[model samples]
Target: MERNIYMNTITVSEFSEDQNLIFNRVKKTGIPVIIMDKGTRLAEIHPPSLPEKQSRKFGCMKDRLKIVGDIISPASDEKDWEVLKY
Candidate 1:
């Protein structure tokens, strides 16, 4: 996981102490601020910027057949399936 330390942070109790400063930082800095309790992470503060770009490897639904093509295939010299019935 990516660890971003430049983001602001505050204890759970500090958040209750000054709501304005926390709100302002989130608005102006546009960075996340974590709320902690007893050194354990409790909550995060940040606004999502934009959706992630779609991967080019998968392309679109039109490539369904191509995906199936990548699946591993059985050996061409394999014995007949009738042996499986026994």
Candidate 2:
């Protein structure tokens, strides 16, 4: 499913007073707000997701098996790892 996670840009000055408005919006709708300060990006505020996605697939069982298989597969012998020892 395509989830709607919106990000909006607002000047830092405008965000100083309307911070509550931004927090309320994120809390209510789970959207994000990017605050810009003097033309440079400042900060981002948003509701946290229920669970963070796994960043390293090797940490999982299926991924570990797939990675191990790839490493031991006959095709893996075509490449040499000694050259990468440095």
Best by lDDT: 1
Q: Model 2: per-residue lDDT, tens digit, 1-86?
A: 01212347777667776667678878898767787878888888878778977576565666444344355455645456666666
Estimate every model's Cα lDDT from 0 to 1. 0.69, 0.67
Give each model's clash number.
Answer: 0, 0
Query: What lDDT does candidate 2 reach at residue 66?
Result: 38
Tens-digit per-residue lDDT, 22-80, candidate 1: 77767777888888889899998886577899777665667465454535776443556
Q: In model 2, which runs have C-alpha deviations exceeding 4 angstroms? A: 1-7, 51-86
TM-scores for candidates 1 onward, in order: 0.45, 0.47
The TM-score of predicted model 2 comes to: 0.47
Q: Please estimate how well model 2 matches the true structure, expressed as its whole-model Cα lDDT.
A: 0.67
